[model samples]
Target: MLISVQALRALAAWVVVCHHFMQIFFDFHATGPIGQFFTDKGAVGVDIFFVISGLVIYLSTQNKDMPAGRFMVNRIIRIVPAYWLYTAAMGLLILVAQPLMPHAAIDWTHFILSLLFIPSENPGGYGMYPTLNVGWTLNYEMLFYLLFSLVFLFEQRHRPLIVAAALFAVSEVLTRLGVISHFYRNDIVYEFLLGIAIGVFHRRGWIANGLWLPLLAIVGGLLTIYHLAPSDRLLHWGLPSAVIVLACVSLEPYFQGNRLLKVLGDCSYSVYLLHVLVLYGGWLAATRYGLNPYAVFAVCVPLIALGGWCSYQWIEKGLYLRLKDWLDKRRNDGELKALSRQEY
Candidate 1:
């Protein structure tokens, strides 16, 4: 049985929620250890999410005969449907709540850019616009998917690793040379490449024995914390992120059964997609009711988790599985037809 990477995904989502909560409630510019820490670390969750995405995607494709079209279709089906639903829901919510929150204006241009998964050129903003901050990561993810698909389409399996590595190197060099803006050249592709490397290692049985693996993971985590720049924290942590990933995959079955963790993992994607709304909504409710931030989290976390679970059960799982099954069947049928035609 494969280890569930859901736990890592869930953890990353919660971390981001916590980071956002701190940002919204606490004064990050305040003079204190806690304030400084929160300010410095708010984006760590995003990094974790990137690493996890890379690892999961790599694992999904390992040892599988995934054609380019099939791979692209599978990825789009997994991500786009839920993302579009959330985007529409958030867009509508923003519209309805705009009267109450006068600052919640929609920029049609930015909204269109977001729909295309393109990062907006608007300065000092998370995405093309500021409607939803979490949407920026989705933009990066979509870009990575497009690039990954293109590479898979034209390059043979043997060449993909080199091509991906070269792409990463070029992007990095461009960023360092100031040819590309830091915002545009941020190191996400490298993280994805690191994930692919981990997948390759797993396939080659090069991952070391139990204790050494965890130890390396711990070291990688430390390196991530130390070497990660404020803007590139998440990207820097990719290796450590992979180490943690390997550890989890190695240890998942031995844990036998932690129903709670497993359940959280199962609802992880929903948690990630919905937590921003929960955090924002919780903050608004708390402010209106004069509740403490920690108190807000207390109520919000469980409610968000429950919401995530419901979304997973009612939306993501149903749609993803059905779509995947339909695609697989279609692929199989096409293959059979081709074979029959050749025989005739």
Candidate 2:
């Protein structure tokens, strides 16, 4: 994996965290120009994530012929364990702290769906969100994985084109039929296609090497995103995200990953999952003291990052290693059984 991508992942998680921080500390609807920019646009981090997901997944499997089952297993191991643990933990927190924290009414159906990463309308009429609201992105991630896995059934050299064609056909048909509004059918899926395109370009040595070109793309993309109204569709966010990603990967030769960025990237998933709780807790404490908003932000952002790092070490990495060991043991046991049968 490209080291820069990991750093980018950490940057994306923090952007979302900062956006939520703005919401918790101020009148969310009444932000000034700069504050409004962060609040309105911070969620674009999700767009960046989708693009990265496409690029990374495609690149990871582009040259190697992987079994669909193995692909699914690796993806599940990376995503499910940490997500379910956090979902359950947060649910318990909501139940215990109901009076102290404002939470949506628990709908058992949606709760179950959220646990399974199924797309469903949030129980409390908050639109299409899971019990752990940020997990709506995971639903998309899982869906993308499922869709991308289909390409593995085909030849390795052709998988990229096959996946792109399948996505294009599906996205176009779904949009034309007016089914795109459904949670599962949203056009946002196309953003992954954009990422796949970039991955293919990079793999084929088609990306331009000139530094000026990427810089121009990056600047132009930002300007477009800046001018976009809050309600714009996938193109508004996805295109700029694609541009930024394209530029980053093209200029990868000039980039070097430092310890701080590497750490953040390693913990990016933990950071994304845990930041909400940390920031909310900080909000509760800071509000009681009538602290300056800026001071509250200054204190809370670092706390959130620290919380994420600790969680990564204690929770995410620990569980992941344990799960991997168990899976490995199971595979070894099966191999031994097969060997014994053959010897007999």
Candidate 3:
């Protein structure tokens, strides 16, 4: 893995954490440069995340053939366990203390839908969000994975990135025109396609190593995402996210061997999953004691990081290895049985 990519992953997750923290800041009227900045640009972390997902997926199967089933299985392993844990945690929180979590709700049907990654109305009346609101992004991710897997079924003549791009273009048009109600008409999906394009270009050596290119790309991406007004998400956030990703990939060499950043990246998923819970719980407690929201916000970020690290170390890591080993053993046992049957 590119250390730069890992660092970006870490940074992106924390940026999202900050974005959510800004919500806390706002409720307490703690408007400032930092809070306002996050209010404007913090949500772009999701854009960054979407772009990174596309880039990483492209690189995963670059110049290689991976079985679609295996690829999907790995994704499910990587995502589902932690996701389900947090979703259930949120649902449980809502159930046990309904008054404390006014922003949350629980419904048996929606809970099941959330577990299945289906886009259903949040019982909390928060649009198409799942019990764990972050899981909504995973819904998009699972869709992308399912679409990308189709490349494995077709012949090598169809490049996966091109296929993804075409699918997004067609789906967007159809969904927007109401010709396809099944697909959500969202501009954000283009962000993934942009990432795929970047990966394809990077592999083809099309992104030059010129210092000015990367610097300008990163700076321009930030400006467009943060400052551009009256623009669609695809234009402001998605395009800028793609440019930033390209810039980050270009500067990968400088970040190599950075252990702390890499560790943060490794725990990024857990941090992303668990931060809201920490924020909510901490804020609730802080309010009870009349603690300052800004101070609580500051404390919650590190606490979330610590909790994420622990979850990554024990549950996420342990579950992945156990599940992978069991699957491997089963496959091996099946192969051995087939060999014995052939001999017999």
Candidate 4:
């Protein structure tokens, strides 16, 4: 059996949490090469997430017999509830905090667009809207999810890899031509396609011989660490990360029945969602108490992880399971009623 992708997702989230903590606490402006390097590399965590998201979603759909509508419904059900909750919470936080920050004027249009999970077409900005820096990735994810759903709707699973590749090529071309900015265009489809290809290859037994897997993983890791410029790192590093993850998952033995990793994976979502809050909270407490940046990490990292695990157990997991079951039962009952009518 395939290992749960949740483990990988959680890992990616932790990577991101570390990245953000580095930014919040470390004095990037005055620090040496080491600090600069980490600050630059931290964003690569999102690329890992994109690649993993593609792979896992593709795998989930690849073998299912469900209709496309049901698949889309399930995906939306899984993501939107927690996302909307976070978005609302963040919005309120922003409103409360804006008085002190006195930063950019709030662009209501872009803010609304973000809430709807649409990528902002506006120019003159590098990061996300002032309040929600972490949200930019969600736009790409929502876009990929919609596109993937459409692909499923057409019953074209066999050709999704090809379509994904084509989309990547188009995105690259558009970026070069200045029709789309680099920040706006990405290799989401390509990374996802790579994952799908890996899944297909694994299902065919090609990966059973692990001779080349480690070599590929090493190469990918090197490219991830070195080849990509800071801005283009996602595209450059994401491919390798996807390959490494695919190879790792294919091994199966390493992950099978690993209780600790599985628990971490289960709590990953909560970790991802709540880590930023923890970091910011820590920053406030540390500054108030005159704690050093490094000292703050020493205290906050484990605390945040534990808090995330608790939130996962008490909040995310419970809410997800209950909501998922309710949605599934509702759908099943509707189907049953329809079938009965057809029998009559």
Best by TM-score: 3
**Winning model by lDDT:** 3
RMSD of 2: 2.7
User: What would the per-residue lDDT of candidate 2 be over residues 1-344, giving only the tens digit for each residue?
Assistant: 66667777888888898788787677466458877877888888888888888999988885677678778887898888778877877677667666766645566787898998877787667688887778999988887787788887887777767776776665666646866535755667778888888888988899876688888988998888888954655789888989888887877766665677678888888888877777666776677787777777788778877878887887777776788789889988998999999999
Instruction: List per-candidate RMSD values in Å.
Output: 3.9, 2.7, 2.3, 3.8
How many angstroms is residue 22 displaced in model 2 relative to the true structure, after the best TM-score fit? 2.1
Candidate 3: list runs displaced more than 4 Å.
Answer: 25-30, 173-183, 210-212
For candidate 4, which ten residues in a row score worst on lDDT?
Answer: 122-131
Worst 10 residues of 2 by lDDT: 178-187
State the C-alpha lDDT per candidate.
0.67, 0.79, 0.82, 0.65
Q: Residues 226-254, candidate 4, lDDT per residue (tens digit)?
A: 65665545456766677666766655665
Candidates 1 and 2 compared: the better one by lDDT is: 2
TM-score, candidate 4, is: 0.82
Ranking by lDDT: 3, 2, 1, 4
Q: After superposition, how far is residue 40 of candidate 1 from its true place, in Å?
A: 2.4
Give each model a TM-score.
0.81, 0.90, 0.92, 0.82
lDDT of 1 by residue, 1-344 (tens): 23345666677677776666676666345356655655666566666667667666766655566566767777788777777777777678777666655545566786676676766654333334434657778766765666666555443466446547655755677657876445547665567666666667766777644655675776777567655665554445656676677776665555456677777777777777777777767767787889887788788889888998988877787888998899789878999999999999
Evaluate model 3: give its lDDT.
0.82
RMSD of 1: 3.9
Clashes of each: 2, 0, 0, 0
Q: Where in model 1 is the C-alpha error above 4 Å?
A: 1-4, 27-38, 99-103, 121-130, 151-166, 169-183, 212-216, 219-228, 231-236, 247-253, 256-259, 327-344
Worst 10 residues of 1 by lDDT: 122-131
